[model samples]
Target chain A: MDFATLLQILDSALRLATPLLLACLAGLFSERAGIFDIGLEGKMLAAAFFSAAYAYITGSVWLGLAAGCIASMVLAGIHGLASITFRGNQLISGVAINFLAAGLTVLIAQNWFEQGGRTPALEGAARFQNITLPFSETLAPVPVIGPIYSQVISGHSALVYIALLAVPATWYILFRTRFGLRLRAVGENPAAVDTSGVSVTGLRFAAVLICGFLCGLAGAYLATGLSANFVKDMSAGRGFIALAALIFAKWRPWHALGACFLFGLLEAFGNRFQNLSVLGVDVPVQLMQALPYVLTVVILAGFVGKAIPPRAGGAPYVKER
Target chain B: MPKWVDVALIPLINLALALAVSMLVILWIGESPFEALAIMVKGAVGSAYGWGYTLYYTTNFIFTGLAVAVAFHARLFNIGGEGQAALGGLGVALVCLAVPWPHWTLALPAAIVGGALFGAAWAAIPAWLQARRGSHIVITTIMFNFIAQALLVYLLVGPLKASGMSPETAPFPDGAALPTAHDIAPWLGFRPSAPLNISFLLALVACAGVWLLIWRTRLGYEIRAFGHSEPAAVYAGIHPTWIIMATMLISGALAGCMAINSVMGEAERLVINSVQGAGFVGIAVALMGRSHPVGVLLAALLFGMLYQGGAELEFEMPAISREMIIVIQALVILFTGALDNMVRMPIEKFYDARRLARQRNGRGTGVAAE
Candidate 1:
């Protein structure tokens, strides 16, 4: 590929990776706190619908973002009540929330808008605009790195920068902070954390709510920033793809960025080259699309390296007499 | 404390709560809950035509629900019913299309084996991974669902697309067609186009077979033993690997049999999205039914009614879309599965309070009798 083409693909890659990165970090927080969330998809979908719905209604992107986060947090709260408060099966609760989001989004969309479960497309300030870095124009006349900076790094929605910035933020919070240490301890062994005079339930719910907040950003980026309107099931399988990326990255923040970016690059290539071939043999695009899932399955099966989840994950905590 | 209360009363209360919440949602949508409920009831059971569609959907759920229930008996969760049923559709297509049959009687047996084997094969990989490598089946199964969809879409749009226009296979020959409701119960004057077919009887047989296998056989005893306590089952000479694989196979096969109803029986062609959300519905059914075959049957019928009635509601009241059924289904799962603890604890506390009051009244002899 030419450098220009590669840069274009990279630009799209960055755009695509933003949502995955945010959702992956969201999963990282929840699963690190011993909460297995298969409902990430549903949560993102709810946020997507609400963000678009609100953005279209109020014509203020900030309100839409706030509404998105609150909507996602509500579902996160439901997950907390079911799994933590009631001590029910975490996986079952996640599954129910997913269905809840999936059904409620389309139902509410159809009720409010008569256009078949879709909000009217947003234009102008109701949607996120691409942000060009300050030096983008000045560096345009330089060498290869100039155009790369201008095209790939400079021009992206603000959410993309936020997603990129979150990698470091997550690392700092998860490894360098007292709360992060407690959160990790709660996931690995809640009883130990409880014995240390920390409330295990409080830390876990905090992690879950933070997860909701990040997912809110991701979903809003999709509807209002990426595509301009909410489409039915618009989150698609990206949440699962994010989960797969989280597992592939072994639950590390920086590694999550790499994994999501790589998956995004694959999608970019698939979209760019519809009739891709390798060594005189045709390669189906579906294979590329399915790679994240296939890779996660392979990793989980221990065919490559082991990817163990949080030690206390998927189990509700109970105090023994 | 009582068997009937645990089995019947708690589920009733949970269902009532789910319906109440659903009604509230209807009211929020600016519709009359009572009117919607009346329309749904009248549409689902008021006529032979409604019964036909309800039973058709009931048959689909029966196959998938039993699949989940048998696996639940072994303490295994098989959520790949969607993928398995998709493969089952491929199997049915091959059986009914690849070879010529003089009549559906001959084709039915062959299609059943084809569907069961394909579904079982798709499930075997995840089962083996879970049993041998200690990989979680939940992760593997959900991933396999995405892979299955990708694979089927590739095939349907490429090699399997016989019509060259749509992403579907050519219709099977007339001889391969299953007998519809009108063929058997013409006296009732059901709609000729209704999809209630001979596969409904097959679904009934599957329920009976699953019941016998779970409660009446040695393997069933082993399965229940394993589910109750792994260490004890192992001590009793039960092979965990065998139980896991065998239960999953049975589960996948049952999920596959659903193709007999939806794919070959209804569509008469292999199409993308043939499984729809029936596989996930099976999870809700199995949970609501308490993993019992009889319970699965009842839950399946309830869902079938919702599905048929939801369609009617969508037609009669365009404002209330068909997705309302999905919202109701989600509520049922939320109430009956994840939040059941919320429902059960209150009832348990009530029973405990009553028992305590009885003991305080100098009727403590009743406790010993219990």
Candidate 2:
């Protein structure tokens, strides 16, 4: 109700929204290219563990970021290999990747650190320290805009800025570029794209790789930026939530950002307020925590306009030739 | 080349591939793969006690696997088995705790009906959304899993806790407990005190019932027809809405039956996190089994071995932790389900080539004799 409280809630919402935003964009690329990637959670989990492990070993956050991306890319490549090259079921491949990541991350972490499937706590250069924006001190003396600039906009990890910037970048690539056109065409109808003399597989593989890159950044931020270490199943269900957000947005990049913020705000409120009462009634905490999922279901069920997926999504393409 | 190949050889080959990869992982972990395999075998089936535990786990997997397989028959992915099973536990707890039954026999049926109804009710929303509103079943079912967990947490912490600090209910009444495997172990010349219970018999009966329903009944025909081709089934006058709703209700009921084993037989209380990833494990089981009742039984037993063996592996070789078993399970699922065509296509091609050579040779001999 108060301004400061509202500002604090918004700040938490932004922080929570960053990972969801990155992952939504990741799914955007994969789905736009006709690949349904339910394994985003698994990819993020793998990236989180590898990033934290490498970061702890090298004491360099940059190296950790690289390792995280590579780890995710490897998984994305495996998914591509299974679903595309082998012409396997995409959902099954995604499920396998989730199980594989859940098991291997903990197994390897135990072998290396012996800390019950967790990486060592990161600090200093090993972690993504918050960046206070320029003129924060000068801005603090200003009126309402001062706190808005310093408190709400500034003091976020660098990855937060990257995630915010990725929205427009994704929009530009998806709607403005030649590759984007090909990607969209491939998802809608691979046969049309193939006849156009563009290799359908190549475009899809490219999109999946970009998905891997963005998911990696999201996972890295969760480990090295938001939290200090990797824990078992730390990605939890964020990947699925991102998928929900993606569907809620109807595959648009800008709408995906809005959806992520909405879900993030729900999560923030759930965390802050254990219980709420409206008028003379009581509202349960479980219902509050479930609001995002409930809303996504309602939206999908045509309470909002129908959320149509890519036409060729989840099907492996095969050329008759 | 034959029906047997698809039914038997393919699964065996996939199992071999998964185990081979697991062996490599073990080697990488600085343990002898042979030793790990030996220990796992001994741990899972070597003793009466081990068999007891294996069968107990097998019971849980079988119920969940059948749940998944039933929905799969109608081309519906019911990923909410975890949630359904959780709610089923709530149902069983409510019935068992609400009234002091005169006997275990009377209480068993009540619990089963209660569990099935609750689980089916949980699944109905997702099924309706998928059938009527065009929402994706996979997404809704998955979301339901999270909501189910949160709901269970709230109940256990608030209304269900029985005057204790722990987030679990008190034990059920004396008459509510199912007969454990220990009661039967003596007559079978086995050791007593294993957790295997009467629910295992129920699982066997359910398997038989599923087999009959799938192979002998008209409804099963409609379900399979719909799964094979939705347009064809629709043209044949089968309503998609009815098929979807009916199939999911059956699936949810089977999933809820798992509570009979974990809640009534083993724990005898409503506990948090009781499902313990068994619902997802059922997906792997159904996949490996190829959705056949007999195959599901076999796959469930194998997973049961992996689970019990994995526990043993941790005790025998600390380097190979329990999570390693999950890695193995994932590999099996990956090979059997996702990469099924990878091995199948090559084998089919090999058989085709061999048959072609035989035919040509026969023709060449006839020409020479003429």
Candidate 3:
């Protein structure tokens, strides 16, 4: 492939990786606090639909993004109420939220848009544009890897940069902050944290709400950054993929960032292979589509050495008398 | 009140809560909530034909529910029922079309056995991975669902494509089709056109078989013991790992039965999308049934009513969105999971009060005698 094309592919890979990165990081926070947040997909889906709908109505992408975050936070609040406050089973509550989001999004979309799904196509102003990094254009004429650096590293939506920024930020917050220590303590042993006068429920609820905000951004990125409009089920197992990444990363933010990129690269390569009919060894489109999921299984089975989830990951915490 | 009455009250409260949530959703869509609910009820159990269709759908759910419940009994979640059922349907379809069996008795059993084996094999991969590699079953099963969908799509469109047709297999031979009671519909006083068949009877038999296996057999004891406390089971020399694998195989076999409904009983052909979402719905059914065989059967029938009723709502009440059914299902699960815990305290208090009253009465009688 030409250098320009290679650069284009890399750029596309990074852009595609943004949503998974953000969502995986979001999951990292909640799960690190010992809550299994399977509802990430549902939160993202709900946010994406609402964002696109708001964008379609007000012609303001900013408002749409804000609305998306608010919608996701609301979902997170409900999850927190059920699983954290009421001490319900985290897995079941997460599943319920997923079902609720899946059904509610479709119902409301059908009601308002009058289409089974899908809002109107968005205009350029309503979508985020690529940022041209300084000196990149002039540097593009140099060598074989120049175009790769220029295209892949230079022009992209703001979310890509933000996602990259989140890795270190999450690390700093998780390992270097008092709040992070408290969150971890709550997850590992709520009673101990309670004895120390730290409110376990409050900390976990905050962690979940933070997850909601991040997931909302991830959803907005999908709808407004990656595509012009939202499609039904468009979040489409990405949440699960993010969860896999969290496990594969062993619940560490920087590791999860790497895992998300790897998954994103597999997806991008799968798409590339679909277009190539190599010497009568053409792969079926469906198989190409299934490649990432297969790779996820293989990696988790073989390479994810040992997953040590939070000590209290799915256990409901109740105060001991 | 009676103990059975107390037991019944929880589910009823859950149902009522779910209904109230669904009504709010219906009202949000600018439809009369009462009218929409009326349509759902009328469509589900209002007529004999409706009952038949409900049973037909329930057959698949019962099989899948049993699959999930059996796995839950071993403390293993078999989320791969989606993939297993797909693989099962593929097995049945391939055998029905490719194998030559002159007798119906032989062909039918062969098809079912083929399906069960395929389903079992599909589930065994995840089970093996989990047992050996420390991989979580939930992630593995979710990944397997995507793989199965891709494999089915590839097979349907490529090698198994019925000549000159769409992406589906050819129809099964007469020997393979499950004998339906539709021909005897007139004598049975039911609609002649209903799609109800012998699969419903097979499902009921399977339910009874599962109940017997779970309650009456040594293996069932091992499975339940493992579920209740894995460490204790291991201490008791039950080999919890092997039991888990065996439970997955049994669950897969039950899911395979669901394939018979689609491949041999209903469609008589392998549609690539035939598995639908029944496998996931089975999880909800198992949970609502509290992982009991009889409870799974009842829960499956209730879901079947929802499915049949949802379709009718679309036809009868044009203004009501058919997707309301999914909303209601979500609410049911929410209530089932939440209300289950919510009722525990109250029920315990009631029983404690009854015990205290009996103790007071006994003391008074003793004192009077003295």
Residue by residue across B1-370, what tens digits does model 2's lDDT show? 8788988998899889999998998899788999998999899998887888899999999999999999989988888899999988888888889898778899899999988888888899999999998888998998888888989999998889888889999899999988887776567645566889999999999999999998899999999999999999999999999999999999988888889889988899999988888888889999988899999999999999989988898999987778998899889889998889889999998777776776688854433332
Strongest candidate by TM-score: 1
Question: Where in model 1 is the C-alpha error above 4 Å?
Answer: B357-362, B365-370
Better candidate number, 1 or 3, judged by DockQ: 1
Question: Which runs in model 3 stand beyond 4 Å of their true positions?
Answer: A144-146, A275-285, A302-304, B1-6, B188-193, B349-370
CAPRI-style class, candidate 1: high
Q: How does the DockQ of candidate 1 come out?
A: 0.81
TM-score of chain B of each: 0.98, 0.95, 0.91
- Note the Cα lDDT for every prediction shown: 0.91, 0.91, 0.82
RMSD of 2: 2.5
DockQ of 2: 0.75
* lDDT of candidate 1 over B168-187, digit per residue (tens): 99899888999999999988
Q: What lDDT score goes with residue B325 in model 3?
A: 73
TM-score comparison, 2 vs 3, better candidate: 2
DockQ of each candidate relative to the true complex:
0.81, 0.75, 0.58
- Top candidate on DockQ is 1
Q: Each prediction's interface RMSD?
A: 0.8, 1.1, 2.1
